[model samples]
Target chain A: MSIFSNLGIRGSILGLAAIVTGIGVTRSCDGGGIVTSQHRVDLTFWNGFTGPDGRRMLEIIRDFNRENPDIQVSMQRMDWATYYNKLMVAAMDQRGPQLFVVHASTLPRMYRSGFIENSARLYSGSDPIPSADYDPYVLQQVKFKDQYAGVPLDIHPQGMYTNAEMLRAAGIQQPPADKASFMRALRLLTKKSNSGDASQWAFALTLWRNNFQSLIPQFRGRYLKPNGDADLNNPGNIAALQFLGDLSREKLIPPPENGLGWVGYRQKKVAMVWDGVYMLGDLLRLQGLDYVAAPIPQIGPQPGTMADSHVLCIRKGLSEAQRTGAETFIRYLSKNSIRWAAAGQVPARRSVRQTPEFASMPVQSAFARQIPFMMYPPRTPVLFEVTLEIDQAVEKVIRGNADAKTALDLANVNAQRGIDRDRAEQKIAPAGGIQP
Target chain B: MQRTGFLFLAPYAVSFAIFVILPIVVSFVLSFMRFDLTAQSSAGFVGFDNYREALQDNYFWSAVKATLLFALMIVPGLLVIGLSMALGMNAMARGQAAVRALVFLPGMLNIAVTGILWQWFFNGEFGLFNFALKHFGGQGQPWLSDKAFAMPSIVLMSVWWTVGGTAIILLTALQQIPGMYFEAAALDGASTTRMFRYITLPLLKPVMSFVVVTTSIAGFQMFGQAFMLTRGGPELSTRGVAQYIYETAFNSYRMGYGAAMSWLLFALISVFGIFQIRMMRRPA
Candidate 1:
């Protein structure tokens, strides 16, 4: 009944292989002579860095191309909003770039797509990129079954962005670092008008998913178990949600429905917000806004924040020269990552972070302090579904539609159903079935 | 002659088979299987499971409800506004073209631009709508974030974005209704309202049926306006079935489920279309 069956799996595979080999042969010849004397390996690098960060990445790639004569790396930038979909399609068609960038949290899904090269290939050279430079926790995110999926480039961790003028007006000289002081500062900064409406807000939930990811771990809980089962309604998660709900209930912050807190902070009305370090570019563009960046305060028994890294990934099934060129370019980028850090991220390489140039960046350095304890979303192929459930539950709790336990309980059930469905589907799937 | 006609139809037929007909057939087959993109090696038949899963899926049902609610708001709004505009333009002795062009301007802009433009208007903190409300001594309304207001806000934007094209189509149909009918009714000393009710309403029934069926179909498939505005937020209250299918197939990589939902939506649209035609075909 199926068309693939009419062609036969082996027949289709042979047809696909012939087409791929034809394309590869033509592409591999697209180098040498016109631009340079030597036979260069032209590597196409794709990434979703279409912001101010894109400019910095362009500069880094240009520098790398100038430095390396035999390997030419051309970069393509796309918006992160639609990047993964495009990447997946390109990979499926076997037209993917030689090298690409994926977020550390997205590594699992991309790995399952079966297009990424193992990390062993990245470290196979005589002068390998040292594994010692990266934090094991960050490294662990890219690992799958004793092999690494990609190389971690930089960590963008959520940190406290505070309006210094508002804090000073409230008689606070330093940023809050713990729960007691954080609450004290919040109360001191909050002002009420005659009608009891909030005149000046103390804090705001900027991005609920990011804020939830940061807070849930501070309360010492997991959204997904080690086996990738839903664990959203844990006691610590409930406590964390209740704490945030109280902030809204007491009017210490506006409810999530009002607007984005980042906008309020930009207008200098909200005193503080926990946001990613990548937001530094937006703040720097604002005129006359006095702000300070610090690590997110420990509000619930521990210090933690959500972090995601840009990982350098090599596409699977490249020629030996292309693979080597990809690894070489990745090594060059890793060594020169301080420039990437300057663009608004914490360099994942410890040696790069320890440099004086990186230390000079107050926000990056402050956010870097949380790298040891930073939380990456659970590595699961069903991550998108799980996150959707968590986002809905958090929104429900913060918007007062349901209590924390009730909302998360519903989310837990929904996410668990998704996991179960995926498992059941996989179990019945025939081995070596045709790829669409 | 037949061979020559076949040659003329060959290009279109070939493309139709490749792009449209083939995909439909493949997806129909895919709906009864497990076709996970991430696990291509494991893809296989699982008869009726995807459909069964969708029937029990809460999110799927919510998506259906959201889409139905959207259709309920938009279809009637388009008909009333479009019919009213056509009637107004028909009565105009001068500046009819100018008024018609003005009514059609918003429809010319792409959905992305319209969505983004209206998103700025609906933003609670600094939106133009909120700014105007505050200037009038009214409190700011959380346009896209309140469950009570979110779908209505989306409907309001949808009306502005699409009513122009609908008005233009109805206006063309209005112009086709000959002046002789009204004149004949006038000879009988019939009142304007009476003539319009008896003649205009009956003549317009076929076009009105066309409008209603097409509008309902488009409304059910709505994705861009809500996606660009609230991202189906305020706890997914505005997320329609199309967006849910997109997320399931592309974002979640569950191709079988997405295809199954797509067939279900196709069935729903077909049912509504047939019901509309049947109801409209009845004698006045």
Candidate 2:
């Protein structure tokens, strides 16, 4: 009753109707109550899949609705930019959907906020989603303490996009796989004119945050530790930044301005770019540009790249039937996520990736090669604050305001302060704490 | 008759109370409480702690600096451009209506459309400005990406988007001045510049004051232009106080901190508003 007060009197009546309907369906199963196939468990689903991926998700939802006569799921989609704010507000007010999608990186904040349910029970039930199908790292991201916060759907990782024509023109037969080959390709592909200006560039940095993050791990550095502490101010991180900074200084790559580096690739002025697998769709839409996708070159000691997953989450405080309906919907979506990968995502399920059809996807299959070594941002409730500091630090380094070490050092201090603030606040409230 | 009049006012009064007054009151109370919407523990009164924290927060100060910088750039820019356009149109005896409408046209566009259109023009790599610059053998300027140019770039777009409305207002005010005073000064052996300075300037003081007060208030509350253009990026140098407050509340889920900042912004706007009115009240 108190929860419904925020909705006003008329809304409270509608809320009561929804609860009664859930109860009515439950009572029908007790044997004496009226049972009808017309009584379907209606569930609302929300996601930030407003792009081409949304059509694939809609098809899955339609299939689920068709297959399950007793359950119907309706989905709402919005741009990722404003989706989290709306979801947070709605969930806080007890007006959120029965099911929703959150990025795996966002799970820590969402779980600590108390708006998401612990999904451990769903994985333990009679028909459970195969936990073995997911990578341990991906699975760990969806866990808060020992409880599962959500289920992974797919992972999107950074992949190196190469211009095949440019590669051929430069007398390169295959994409570069190491620092030696990459630098050689960059030098060979670069074209200079009589006027001392480079008419064509070798590479450009798009989405600085993601680009730098992917590089940091390749250099044997981690942005955040397993326990979610800031590890940005490290030698590996500094080396990664210095490598990119040197490239910009040497004119091997364009300066990180406008964040429109993809435009250069599309225009055939640049030979290579390191961007996310999700950008494959846009590249595919180009009329004449022949491009190939491969794992980002190993610039450091070992192979590493940045990856993030779309996690299927259930809202807290749902009726039993709605919760069950949501779990079933998640399982259906996860099993059929090969279709989701058609929009350029790599399905998180190992079995799904092993399928012949999944291998047929040129971009997705190539990007999937680095999934074993991919990393996500720190799993902290203060993820937003931490990311904010990282973005600024990365920007400062790229814009030539500060060197890599200085920028990362400042960011580390600020990020640590943010973590401390969050810890202190959690101590005061303790309600959202997952620790026993 | 009295009851019917009360009925007519009741709907508006109720809506005003619910939408405007209620939110203001709630925000005021929330400003003093440690209220995080995401946290499990209920809101507790923490009185002035949030306010003190805001004062000490570097991000808050930087955001305030960005906002103040925006206001400083935009208020004068709008006034000068708007006044010049108004005076130019005022001098034109023929086709005044079409020219006035043409000058006021950009104001009709939504901020989203305006921001997007300008974003393409300001983009460094593929922007229209750079495209044209390259054609003329000029270097491409990093309009929105460079910290030095980001706020000014937003102000430029804002002036283009909004100057027409301000010009129209000043044009209306310019037309309202009595012609007799100018004519009398002209007949009294006064030169064009002197007559303008004495008669035109004195008569436009009230309207100028109104424009200043209103433009300053609008400038102080600016959010959409920068938000759409740069998202207060390039190291958060373009982030205004309003954007910061929004990010605090919505993105960070720090409700009490957000509310406290909002109240602080409100107080700052009020103080500036009052000071402008007072300054403008004096005879210029």
Candidate 3:
């Protein structure tokens, strides 16, 4: 109060504004001043790798920082569940990091919102990681409109994790590769109590969304029409859901519950579980458990499995030097993706996958064998809502609460409504034109 | 003197204005606008469109139903358990302070820790509860997964986690009741039951009303327990309004719609609070 009296009210307001402006100015100039004085560019990177993979990523970042004296990339990590919300809020405030990681399926929403930088420029020029190096299917997921939105780092596809000891006990030498053998193995391995309760199951549906999505495509079901309409109620998808329902009805699989499926598999109460390569580290930590990774047994007509990638993206509207530095870091990560794969991932780059070291990782190599047929969920701005609807549908069917046709039909309507709302909010025309 | 008083209040006043009042005002304004974070350019005045959409939204209704169900389950249980625990502790002749501390311990745990601990207990297979059941030759109940059990299971965990705080408040209120009143009643040859009915219950009425209203409000705003336990699963049976609003605002980025629903929930809580206060204030 005495200070305010001395300076006067207007003078105090001006002083406060000046202080704020001074702080802002120093923050804005810090990067440039350091770059000009020491010839070093500082880049901020953010990602949701808050697991075993995070340690691996931290190691890589440290190595990059040590090797590249001219560039400093500081990394921040958070859990994936809340990561997108924080990233979006920061982006809206124009405080987004220069480099970030996003799942390939999430790119559409970010791209549509104009949050991500169009990375087509990185594809050209000297020492570029060529587009040919990535699997075309995985690379295509990062493409939005006519521009590439990000670079794929690694593919994490869901594969069948089998209890090898349980299979051997059932007198089966090899894991099932197709529908008939798979059913036979299930029948042999499943144990029932006198009261008709399943004491042990042959398979437990872990991550039901991925399991259903993988099976639907193998059954020749299209998740979306070419024109971007939901095709969830199609015959092929119905058949897929029916098959999953039958498994529950027959007591071959237990009802999907929290931590039950994975815990059951670990305790040898279940024989097989379809989960992602990210779980390999957790499985490996368990002693005296013999496990093997194989392609999800072919349940339908063709070989297919659900896959997602962790892609590296840049925020829009960076200075030219900043862009260059971010690009260089992305290229370094891409080239060194083999080390990323060591954290239980399939390297996105074909050259990295071909390396003998990658082949030596049995689980990763087994999952990699299905790279050619891996199917990602439909790329849509409203994919989150779509996924929730699909998850609900699958849960209902697997729980024997609703018949497949009814659940799929209801989910189809709900998903279409979400898509329509998204289109209306974004002022986007219906699908024969540019996707919303 | 006034200047010194203002100086003393300045820190709290400034923070309250910035963090609490400002957000309420902003969200009030945002409720009328189409404030989709994903499409910033599309934000504009929509004049009750968001509210209308919430009225038509089935999930909104379901969330409301779930929240009300949770409130019904939790509020009565909290009041009964809290009062009983407080009375029991007050009647203790020895180790009163230690018993009170033991009762209050769970309330000190963070919600996340509480949720995880209870989640381990409620896991259908390989959980402490199920393991105990197997040991006793009983079949394990689907604690978190089934539609019928999910909300009740969450309520059980929440009661364990939060009852301590409520009981402590009631205990303080119990201790504040003068010994003179009970002595006077004893001189009148009143039985223990009659004394409790006439003296203790009457004296504790105001505090009981406070606890009931606040507990009901907190129950209506329940999110963490259900979120950590079932994640609104077994077909969205346990998903409360707060969780739905969170998903709408943060997950779906529909700020306007979320704010609209939040105001509706606020209105519902206010109505319930007023009703409870009025009912509790009436002489039985």
Query: On a 0 to 1 TM-score scale, where does candidate 3 land against the true structure?
Result: 0.95
Per-model B-chain TM-score: 0.96, 0.96, 0.97
Worst 10 residues of 3 chain A by lDDT: A29-38
Candidate 2 structure quality by residue, lDDT tens digits, B27-66: 9999998876667575689899999999999999999899
Cα lDDT tens digits for candidate 1, A214-260: 88779997877655677899998898888887777777788655675
DockQ of 2: 0.62
- Model 2: which docking level applies? medium
- Candidate rank order under DockQ: 1, 2, 3
A207-295: candidate 3 lDDT, tens digit per residue: 78888988877888867887777878999999889999999887678765535577789988989999999998788678988998899
B1-284, model 3: which lDDT tens digit per residue? 99999999999999999999999999999999888777888889999999899999999999999999999999999999999999999999999999889988998998899898998998876789988987999988889888888889999999998999899999999999999999998999999999989999999999999999999999999998888878888799999999999999988888998999999999999999999999998888
Docking class of 3: medium
Summing lDDT over every window of 10 consecutive residues in candidate 2 chain B, give the lowest-scoring window: B34-43
Instruction: Let me know the TM-score candidate 1 reaches against the reference structure.
Output: 0.93
Per-residue lDDT value at A415 in model 3? 89
Interface DockQ of each model: 0.69, 0.62, 0.51
- lDDT rank, highest first? 3, 1, 2
lDDT for residue B253 in candidate 3, whole number 0-100: 86
Residue B78: error of model 3 in Å?
0.5
